[model samples]
Target: MNDTATPLLDVRDLCVRYETSGASSWRRHLTTVLRDVTFRIGAGETYGLVGESGSGKSTTGRAILRLADIGGGAITFDGQDVATMGRRTPLAYRRDVQAVYQDPGASLNPRHHVGRAVTDALRRHGLGSAAERRARAEEVFVQVGLTADHLTRYPSEMSGGQLQRVAIARALVLNPRLIVCDEAVSALDLSTQSQIINLLMDVQEQTGVSYLFITHDLGVVRHVSHRVGVLRAGELVEQGETKALFEAPLHEYTRSLIAASPASHPQGRDERRAARQARRRAGVGAA
Candidate 1:
């Protein structure tokens, strides 16, 4: 676990709304999709938001990136609140907070070369000279396990795993402080998923960057996350240190998820969970 006391990123009471059809107008009947979701990530910490489809994990990530409108609450990154960021400040925020989407093919522009796509953010952030950006793009390709020859290829030319690697390479190019990986590995095969997980851990070891890993895979979370947050129906139901939460959960929904997980056992699991939570809370009380 990270020993750092101060959080690198802090999200508080964040809410997002999407406007569907309404009686007043097209924009008037706004639906609150995500409600008061909150969590924290420290520097070099990997936090996973685990939930099924339509659980609001993507909405939370998008809200922080300002891709979704913030209906309420604060997203603090590097000690600055993003919800309150001015136009001039958002440019810098983009340099620090990058995103990787689930579908690599859809995320990449088919018209652009792999190298061009990877260097787009570098150019936008004005990281270096043209030659430097080109060189770095090629370097990041290797860093993400892609070959140097891929510089000229398009997203359509690569396999799903390769496409995802390119997406990761592109996110890494900017050296962002935090990366919101929105179901980033869900489309890959299991073997490829392991490779990506190893790559992420390796990158974090080399650089102090943290990750906001959003996924439905509980097994993946068990392996990669230092902390985990469970979201259901647009609300954060439970969150704690990964080991602590997995070993001892306080919420019924969390227990239900554990039971349904492939890794769970059928023998006295509910009783075990109850005992664990009781012991944990007792220990906390003693402390």
Candidate 2:
């Protein structure tokens, strides 16, 4: 963990609800997506949120980014309440917090050059003149392992890894203090996933930025996160320092997630499988 007295992002008893139509337009019900979920991320640290599909992992990220409505509790970033920021989110807040989603291709527009993603953000925040924006875009591209020539290419022209790099570049161009990376590397191959993970860690080392890395990959979480929180059915089931939590998970759900994650090596695959079977037979099913 960061060991800092004050965390960069603090989420306290956070609750999120969504209004869904029932049988008809007049019949609607509010579903609680997140319940009293609480966690903290220190500056320059990575906090991994892990869960299976429909476990509220992405919903929590959306709440932090102010894309989802908060039914109760609070999200404090840099000591400011995000939910109370009013209907119009401040430009400074937009500049301070950014997101990198799972599908980079969908997040980008195919009609415009990939460089436009970064340049448009700069233009929105009034960061610099056109010339400066282009220059800055080129700078961030290089920072993310892409060359200036990439600025002229459209999304269709680049590979998956390249598109993801562009997405990271777009988030980095703003010089945000915190990044909400929702399944950022889940779509890539193992090799490319490792590369992007290292790239993110390197960027954090250099820039002192924090990351809310939300993913179901326990292996990735162990490799990158300083601390981790396990979410199950819209609630936090376990949370602690990465090493301690993984080695000695107090919650049965956490143990199941760790067991379900494919081992990095195949040496003890059978033994691990047998153990999992035994656990399941003993009434501790995998989550």
Candidate 3:
């Protein structure tokens, strides 16, 4: 919405690599995971990063959070460089830039009550007394469309959707400026995913928090993203307004991705069947 101001998060020429080793000496090689990726997310904007698995989409999110070791590039948050943050400074950064992972079941501690998990950040940051943290935790729970009473339950006791709402509450408890939603809805069923996506957008609208929403689902991306960026093998081949890009994808890879989405069209199913039949006929003739 506010296009005049500086971006809340800026990433420039980010590159990441991993080392692989063979059985013999001197056989090791470096595999590039992300290559010269650049993007910016303004305050309250949802920037969707969509790609197939192993496309380095998740790695990019981790790199912004400093979970991955970067080979090169600059990641700046609110004009300050995040990659160069000192050990203790990252704690502060964590407060401002939180994350909700794909699996809330895994992200939450089964041993702890959901209330404690939500309040942990407030406690660790020394924001308030135990009673204050508890009260604030309940407020966030309500904000994320959960009853404060649910906070008494453990992660395992809650359904997948309920657990995810709690996970979102944990992120909201911190009042973060940017939340890296790394496939945050992918694990849920379609109806639940829709609920989560709507909740995320609602939260963003209310709090003005930005999201770096990473997912393999182009249809979901189209629904939630203000802008879309398509990554192939770590390279951001196309980035544009979501509607424009989806209506007329510029890149071949981007077009293929949209076409491959099973939700794209009913006609696509017939086309696929026809293609399969054609392939079979061609094989028979060749034989």
Candidate 4:
């Protein structure tokens, strides 16, 4: 519900499909991973996509990052169509839109020190000289709560949270306008998750970078996202401002999702469950 005239990233009527084959002699299938999905993220805004596993949340993120097979629709960034970008435009687009995935250890090379992994993007894009790149890496490392000394360590030397911070620093070094955070905080413990989420908010405030946060945790979405979209069976079932959607979700699926969240107090779980059942019954009776 951003009133901004031009959003930083806009996705409309998006569809994605994967070609699969069964064990049969001649059987092939086209499975739709995402269908008619639409949403927008403005400058410095966080748009959260939440759903259960296989709900297409990660597929949507991949499509936005141009890593998936786009079956239909348009993904526009800064008023430019991503699908149609030619030659050097895609590289520029990648520079503007970076990604941070769930497994930081897998993302970072074990052989190289974290410093090289962080400044690799800068070197690829020819951003600055070695000294400048090192300075930028140190600054970003500090920004994400890491110290200068930690940069010399390899992925094996750091904790899970620290490695994730290094991943975020890598994305930040590019100074991108949009970041596709695919389950970026799901792997951490509760305390570390809170720290990372707060760090992301602080980074946004400092850099005005937008986020497309994809995760299955509704509670995390509520804490980090400005707007929330609920995906069910590859389709967007609900989308609205986070507070409003959590306070009173219009979709039955969304209501059930909220009721299922672990954040619900144990004492009130049954009451919330009953209320959700009643709502489902009322809708069915009315229909």
Best by TM-score: 2
Error of 2 at 133 (Å): 0.6
Per-model TM-score, in order, reads 0.86, 0.90, 0.88, 0.89
In model 2, residue pairs whose N, Cα or C atoms come closer than 3 Å (at least 3 residues apart or on different chains), thus clashing, are none
Strongest candidate by lDDT: 2
Question: lDDT tens string, model 4, 104-217?
Answer: 899788999999987888999988999999999999999999999999999999999999999999999999999999999899998898788878877987899999999988
Could you arrange the candidates by TM-score from highest to lowest? 2, 4, 3, 1
Candidate 3 local lDDT, 1-287, one digit each (tens)? 34577999989999999898878888998889999999999999999999999999999998988888888988999999987874445677889988999888886777989888888879898899989999999899998889989989988789999988988998999899999999999899988887888788778878999999999988788778889899999999999988789889999999999999867322222343466578787885310
- Cα displacement (Å) at residue 38, model 2: 0.7
lDDT of 1 by residue, 1-287 (tens): 45457788989999888978766564467788888988889988899899888999888888877788888988888788888864445677887888889897886788988788877778887789999998999888998888889989988798988888898899899888999988888788878887887788778877888999998878777777889999999999999987799889999999888777776222122343466578787785311
Candidate 3 — which pairs collide?
A: none
Error of 3 at 66 (Å): 0.7
Candidate 4 overall lDDT versus native: 0.87
In order, the Cα lDDT scores of the candidates are 0.83, 0.90, 0.87, 0.87
